[model samples]
Target: MIALLGCGVVLLSACGSMPVTGDIKAVDASQPGDSQVQVYAVAPRENATPDEVVDGFLESMTSDDPGFRTTRKYLTKEASRTWKPSAFTTVLSKAPNRSQRPVRDSDRSSTELTFTLTGDKVATVDAQNAYQPVAPTAFSRSLHLVRQNGSKEWRIDFVPDGLLLGQSDFKRLYRSVNKYYFATGPAADQSTLVADPVYVRNRTDPITGMDTVTQTVRSLVEGPTNWLRPVVDSRFPTGTVLRKGVTALAPDDRNVLKVPLNKKADGVGQRSCRMMASQVLYTVRDLTSARVEQVELQRSDGSSLCVLGSGQAEEFAPDGSSGAPDSQYFVDDEGHVQRIPGSNKGSGDPEPVAGPLGDGPVRMSTVGVARDEQLAAAVSQDSASLYVASVVSAGELPRPAVTSRAKKPEDRLSAPSWDGRGDLWVADRNPDDRRLLRLAGGTGEPSNVRVPDLGGARIEALRLSADGVRIALLLTEDGHTTLKIGRIERQGDPDTLQDVSVVELRKAAPQLADVTAMSWSGRSRLVVVGKEQGGVQQVRYVQVDGSAPASGVLPGANQVSSVAAADDEQLPLMADTEDDGIVKLSPGDNWQTVLKKGSSLVYPG
Candidate 1:
């Protein structure tokens, strides 16, 4: 791989209006002894024993499965495509017993393949057949092991099921290997080896009344090559409309998004990623009455439990104790508010995390919504509290993951959204790692999918586009703003991240400051920004081909703080400011509000 170092000049390229690199460093591997699933490179000794690394990896795959969750980060395009056939599960399933695992056969050979590298032109592979003796079965097939980058780091993948029958391709791949390449038919097709679908929703078009639900989208992840590419299966109905629509009685929109969180037993819940299971998440309703009415519980079963938000305004005294604002959070099936206790905190407003936030730092954040029912919010800083709702870290975790992501306290939670069964996407930043984060997976222990890292800049505001594809983060460093845009998932090599781009606000909206919040008008090709300076709100857009400047800069938005837009083409920017009340920036550059105290607005579920 040393020969490829010259390619650094060819490879490429965050949001926070005034973006900065967080300096999230990779963990120091040399620090005496440390623990983390990571890749290491040691100087080759005079006669270092063969490709021991590959042998070790095969062993680790069975014994220590840590690499399963983060392998995509290091995969090349070809390898990632072959191994991660689908985008979601490349990081979704890690447990040996999950349905995604290959079914163990009684006659299968040992589940092991060791690689030995002797020099530039020669290498050897030893296989431990997986089929067991009881079911003794032997199969032969053609396989290829290709090197990625310049390293002897080889990947063994099948070349389409039976195409190998043609000797030409086989000769092209294995003609140089020792003897004839060792053969073992297909292990389970990786596609069938996915962790079963987590969340699914069944929605019907409101006007047409046609079903919009489709079969389950196994895990929120699929293979990197198949990203954003919809998969249609006959098992469930298939159709999509402008929106993800409401709950129904079918498998597509199975209706209940159950998330499995990423957890480690630290006595109290410490910082980690949260896996939002199958569920569709929606934003909070725009508030009209400013009188702080009450918080209530909305369950997946469609039941409502009123919360007495009065006396319990800011306390964390359990469910029925001290009448705290405990009900304002998300609740699990056991009726317990799933919280991490001491992990919540807020930015610049240090009132000691009053109430349910307790004494946590109050930088609590959220991911998306849960199956259209609850908002995912991290209620603590030291640990994560599900609040039945919402939504960081570093070598603190790994690379790609560290981008956009700041350190623990800074991984301030973002709202979480459940795709249906249990797929969740949480927003976080690690300035230290220069990466943004998307914490994906179940509630037990989440898989951290790193995005292009955004450093030093503080993410004053962020929001996922209603279309569910785009995400906007308003970044600020020393209170200055900059905007960064990139794909939602982290795929490919841990050292090689794809699709992370930054748009300088000064080049777009030069007058904006402390760009606190942002959201995508998904379809209209626009990004809505809420500027803190004089509450100046602006709507800007970039073309897939990179044309035109951010065109829709309104002259009067002195009070808007939050926004949400689905009909991005008709109305691009929605501003909720103290002075502007509610302003809608649309086709005619209009301005108006449908409600007040619009701290948040949504197309309610």
Candidate 2:
């Protein structure tokens, strides 16, 4: 559950617009039924006091305006011109302490309104439309307010860049929306479209729906929202635009979307064209909840260039196949990797994987496997080295794939992660060498992946999503651990990662103060262990959006050492508990020990 730093009051009107003094009512098609609409918030009154203006401005920032036009009203003309709300958005977990004090050595009328910002820095959205995580810290923003000559009204003359909002308001104002991008896979079959999750305003313009279907397409055409931009490409050209502007997108009567492109798609090949259509189809489906069956890409002349069926879109979606492996793999008492058979009903003795890594004398403290279950990466018992070897019998000793450069033995390396591209990811926890590294598959050299500014936090654990686009990291700072997500940006087929190409980190579970272990439970959900400060260790499931289901902690589990779940949400959950070795939990069922003596557990892919 999200921790509330301070109390918050709702400032916006109801979700729907209602008639004022008569029987007539306004039908708001764009109003969100599940959430409130802040687009209709009241603006600051004319000639308001400096404090009121600042408070109103903060409240107005929660409105659903596209360019923050309503929010700029509180600013002076010159200040508004210089202000760029898109530059950044600072989300606070609670309201800040506000005060206005006279600026010294300046005009007596010059007043500086200071906002003592406190509480969790939940998330930050950058000018590039990418959102990243920020650790909880107390910060301040000073707004200089002065009276305008002509109007004699006090407006903010100078202020910090970006908009600020409390956590409660942030939840009601923004929502997670996914844009589909094609993942590089077998060329013969262009399957596997990954979901690049992004947050968009929840409400849209009532008449045009710009915040709905149109926003999804526009964001997609703008390209991947994060580091995925380097690896993923869109078939849409440089200047692709929806016909009739961004607001002109809607499904047709037969559930077919007639997407009129500004540029002609005649040059795109058949396979690429279909892939383009699939991208649009999947993106639109996410908004319309599969109300759209197909997407027909059309030329400016209205001729159909290509059509993508909904069936085709499903063939390569994130959940395209049977999902991640059902069988759970873990390290046994002797440090050998063992597998528990059956999907959710596995019982009896555990079997070792068909490789030397599972049965050899090499003592592995932690392990990770590739998506295809073809290979496994293991960390030595001392956590000073990493080894990657084939899961199938190779008749060779597991070779050292990665060794930490740290001087201390305990801070050497983290458990390794394998992405869909077959690249392995790990973080060096050494305080002096706090860095993330990606190793090319099959004994390739390791390249340092840049980590975003973590506010002096050191990464303790790193888990890569199966899609290879996003990564989960457990960062420890000041004795507190945080869970964050970052995007992986790769330079175009480079032998080594360029300094400019690095994973941009963001907040995925900003509410959780201590997260020891986590695993991707589904495409967007993570099964995490650890709890709020001073709370008992229990397994809780969390979404990539920083929200958790009401299912609460896993039943019959305690002091979970590690947790593992498949990409398929329906599969049973596996975790290594303090007392129980390896336990499995089917939905709505209590935990049952599957392996009597296991340590760490994972599911291939």
Candidate 3:
């Protein structure tokens, strides 16, 4: 074991006689680049008090110690040997407040020190490294300390099972990364990749001694998380893993990443091997500063299995778009569906679409464009019926594909949404006839979608992910609206919908008391408009797993009634505000007025 005296003495001698008078300065602890700050741990000193020992142990949890060697010195021999730091992590809003007291033994011969730790819990990271955020709640834990019969040094006999950290420390140490897997039921010619986001140590991982890039590759081979396992599949075979002693990965001069695999993956076929390589390329594309243009997989004996280029990987993009969208569509003041240029920098003149919905008898209140941009579904001005029409040429509007009989317009129908698979979704909010409906290919007969776990809540609005594997729902119960995400499960052919359902509804933004509008911003994230209890409305981005991203809050908008975003994040974010009409927010810029009067805005799904 490493001696604790070396670190303890150095720290004491450096600050033994320093002056303690200076002007106080304030610093922003939540800056974006704080992750680059390194933390060093100091071991306990000789003859330390009980409070000092407890404080030192808690501070060491935030340090960059390798395997937490110095942290174990503050614990008794038995506790040190049995402690497991990798079990889970509990994150508080700030450093926990500690208070100490004395506890008498049953025989009244000896006394032990008990310290209570209290804070507001913010989130928790499970053993699988999945993050789940919750509403702030009170937290309390206790630690017990005892000294040997003849020793003056105090050591902790009881400690928490896993690590505990504050919000700032947790942000500095961990980073979020997305791993890619193929959607379960897509055909071989139409395989689509889905993202599974998780957290890993920003620098070297203490448990595996692997860097961030290598850690991400290893996680992809391990398969998707439990909640997503029912709707996705991994091409990596069972028992596959990285070669022994491989601890780092980087792109070569030609921007190619070579991955070495164990014997379990040695027998994969050429096609399957390329698919495996695509998964690696997509997973690591955003991790490194230098772009990775290709990926080459190597076998156990140092022979190349197969190679996949970046262009080939685009064949399986989630949205299936050629590139970024060229235009964004919305309903203008005259109830016509008009479109403007999709560039983020400046605004352009808006023009009507090519179909009857753009200039017809039925006035449209909202619209949903197909992923291919060839067709659109529009809800009537009164929200009582939904119509579909071709947008590429002049044509007559089709009859209403869905209709509602609710007396009140607000309780009739919601804005329609199109998924990557060409299916349309909407909800009828009538109290007497509430149902979630889906139309196959936006032209088939509407069918009721079974939501087994919705309890008694009514759907107010809905959005489908670009990959067609997930859905976001705004649910209202007792006059309170909340955001929830559910997995989309289909039980038939890819081209046709036979049996469809949305199951396993989980809260996506538990911190917010009311959700008004939302749009899918990226593969695993959503831009939401909501407010906390007794707080003002705010716009922010949250992951599908419910964790808020670092620097996710956008510039404030007033009374945003609806919002729209493209799968490609480079496009501008559009929203309709009651006070500012229709506004667009681009990257690194403030909100700008796009139109003085508009109700709903949307991009191709």
Tell me the TM-score of each prediction against the true structure. 0.31, 0.74, 0.92
* Candidate with better TM-score, 2 vs 3: 3
Instruction: Give the least accurate 10-residue stretch of model 1, judged by summed lDDT.
Output: 175-184
Worst 10 residues of 3 by lDDT: 7-16
The reply for model 3, stretches above 4 Å from the true place, is 1-33, 104-111, 186-190, 321-324, 341-346, 494-497
On residues 246-353, what C-alpha lDDT tens digit does candidate 1 reach at each position? Answer: 323131132232211111111211111111111111110011112322333222333432223334332321111132111112222222222212122100111211
| TM-score sort, best first | 3, 2, 1
RMSD in Å for model 1: 25.7
Which candidate has the top score in TM-score? 3
Model 2, 1-605: lDDT tens per residue?
01111222123322122333333333222222235433444456665766677766765666655466667888888998998776677877665557666556565645444333345566676654455655577767677787777665778888788867766665566666667776652221236677766666656733235766776677777778555665566777777767666475777788898877776455667787788888887777757644998889887777888888877666666644444466667787888887766443455467888777777778888888887777888888888888887777756765687777787767888878877666788888877777777877635777777665666888888777767666888888888877877766654444444332345565666657788888887776788887776667667877675654445467648668788888777778888887777788888778887766778788775
In candidate 1, how many Å is residue 121 off? Answer: 48
**Pairs clashing within candidate 2:** 132-506, 133-506, 133-507
lDDT of 3 by residue, 316-373 (tens): 6655544745578889888889877665332888889998988988889999988888
Which residue pairs in model 3 clash with each other?
Answer: none
**What would the TM-score be for candidate 1 when compared with the true structure?**
0.31
Q: What is the Å distance of residue 195 in model 3 from its true position? A: 1.0
| Best model number under lDDT | 3
